[model samples]
Target: MADTFAAIATPLGEGGVGIVRVSGPGSLNIMKVVFKECPDKVEPRHVYYGHALDASGNVIDEMICIYMRAPHTFTGEDVVEFQAHGSNVSLRLIVMSAISAGARIADPGEFTKLAFLNGKLDLSQAEAVIDLIKARSEKPLSIASDQLNGSLGQEIVAIRNNIKDVLAQMAVNIDFPDEDIEQVSCDEFITELKRQNDRLQSLIKSSEFGKIAREGIKIALVGRTNVGKSSLLNGLLGENRAIVTDIPGTTRDTIEESSSIGGYPIVVVDTAGIRDTDDVIEQIGIERSKNEIEEADLVVMVADGSTELAAEDFEIAEHVANKKVMLVINKEDLGMTAAQSDIDKLKSIIGCDTGDIVYTSVKTVKGIGKVRDAIERNLARGFIKSDGGNIVTNERHKDALVRAKAALVHGIELLEMREPLEVAEIEVHDSFQILGEIIGETASEEILDTVFSKFCLGK
Candidate 1:
């Protein structure tokens, strides 16, 4: 029998409530010994107010207890949860009490590990639980929730089943030579393989958007001094996150904040203004700003809409020439000395495309919405739609999908080349095994340990 384990499930802090979770064979018996119930008999699946007692039968803490019977709990084993005061002393005492009552300290992710071992969840769903916890944006939370609910798992299972069907056909041909059943036709084999390959390709493509949603897009704000870069960042964030002043060189370091625009999470970074400076620190900051602009996923090159474009502005534009850039003209309240035609001339001189220009005034908050809309439009250009089905989110899944697709494709190629069934069978079998690994049908112990180890203790 698996050893019973207990742990403080919640983060370590003083709060309204703290939870001590127990799972495995001895969970109920341990609870019965430490938890004094009002009804005396342990009621399964019901919460009851109780007092936790030490070995001496003295009251250690007042608590609430909920007992979940085997095969119905998170780990598919008996579980007991102690809801006690969220004080450090009270919480630790409760855990220690459970430990003394024949429970062991749960390792990181031990509870979830039990869940996986007991068939309560697959590898993907268990992973989604952690992803949900670490999700930084609403979209990511939604995606992770979908995965946790078995959406992604079901999709992988479906694809795996398709591969299994093909393998089954190949197996019949191999196992029934006396029946004289005709082997799978090359044309038919290639057709089905192409279809499955297409499906896998579609999923791989979905990762482009899934990746953007999972890892937020980086937008670096770059421009010459006194060009309203800080104000633009403040405008996008809807708060005075960056210090904005009439003085030049006010922001000497990068200021970063996360915000969502049109359902996309973006990290807006305001860097030191790009200009020649006498101050050593300011020059260092400028150098760093140049580096950030180059490495940024999207560059918002801010310029003063009211003033004529300067040599420093042109220089900043030239620096970001190869990057995905948006020319943002700030301070529209004062109007520009350069007309749209003049702006056109500056765009040519700076080598930025005409469509990338965004005219805005941060003081009045004018054109900020337009700029936001433009960003969303640009980011959404190549986004993948899931069609309400399986899409991969991590490197492991991607690798499995790639290998499975490769095996299937190679199998089909063999059939097309009129190669012996023996040759094609190897690739097809390899593909089936790869698919099995994704759904944990053929996963190794090392893979399971590495995945579950990432989970928090007590799940």
Candidate 2:
């Protein structure tokens, strides 16, 4: 028998309502003992208004409660939920009342862990539940929801089914070599293996986009002080997130905010200007700026179009030469006073031959739209378009595919060499079992513990 567990499902704070959840074989019994107003034969799936009592019969709260019976609840066990006032004290007391009635405080993710153990959700789907809760944008939420609904799992299962069919053919050849059956030709084996290999490789390649969708792209804005970096950030963010002033190194540290480019999540980081400075703090900030550029997925090299490119400008350009870079010549409103030769020189140094170079006047928000377009074109060239595709967002799933792909490739090589069917079947079966780990069909205890450990209490 599974031990009963109870927890506060909702966030702890003052709100209109909070939920206390209980799950296990003893869930209904605990409810019957604590909910004094419900009849002795309380019906499942029915709502009841009552005052909950502790084991000693002390009233804990007056609230609405619902009971869901075994095999249909979230944990596939008996469950009880209480909708009470969102009082820290009251909700804790309610949980305590349930504990007093024989339930224990649920560990982090224990509820969802039970769901996984009870066959309610596979390992990937159970993992998606946490991803769904943590998603901050539309695309990530959609991807997580799809995974929860078994999109990725279904794909893996389908691939496994194809491999099983191939294994069956190989099995017939092994079981009865002289039984007058059509043998699996090497050509047929090679063709089917190649097809399944293509599908597996495509799914693995989607992990890059999946990671971007989950963590968002990081874009760093780098330039000298007073070159309108702050102004540009303010304009793009549509607010004054960073201070704009004539003082050099005003932004002593990195200022970051989340935004979207072409509906894909992005983190725009405005770093301190990259320049030679004697002030210790400004030097520190400049060093941090260099680190940000190194880590950024995209670096925007802002330059003053009103002045000639200086040694510092060229030096900054060199720093971002290797990264996916854009050159934004700010202060175009100053009449493009800087010679075109110098502007072209800056781009040449930064290697922005085919990259975006949009002039902007941040004071008037001129060319801001072009900047956004340039960002989309530069950073999100191959970004997923949220077209309801099965984007593999988990590293574990990707690893399984990678190993499975290797196995399939090996199996194909063996078949191509005209090896015995029994020899190739071993690799094919390995591939099948590896994929089974993704959907929890053959997952071990350690993997399950590691996954559920990331979840919050009560799911």
Top candidate on lDDT is: 2
Candidate 1 has a TM-score of: 0.93
The reply for model 1, stretches above 4 Å from the true place, is 346-356, 364-368, 382-389
What is the alpha-carbon lDDT of model 2 when measured against the actual structure?
0.87
Q: Candidate 1, after superposition: displacement of residue 196 in Å?
A: 1.1
- List, residue by residue over 1-459, the lDDT tens digit for candidate 2: 789999999998999999999998898888888787878787889999988786678887788889999998889999999888889898988888899889999999999888888989888999999889988777788889999998988988898999999999988988988998989777897899899999898888899898888889898999988898888788778898999888877999989998877766889999999888789998998999989999998899898888876788888988899988899988888877778888888888877755588887767755777788888887556466444558988998899999999999999999889898788889989999999999999888998888888988878
Q: What is the lDDT of residue 170 in candidate 1?
A: 75
Candidate 2: count of backbone clashes, pairs at least 3 residues apart or interchain: 0
Q: What tens-digit string does per-residue lDDT give for candidate 1 at 126-178?
A: 88888788888777788888888988778878877876777778777778856
**Index of the highest-TM-score prediction:** 1
Question: All candidates' TM-scores?
Answer: 0.93, 0.92
lDDT on C-alpha atoms for all candidate structures: 0.81, 0.87
Cα RMSDs, all models = 2.3, 2.4
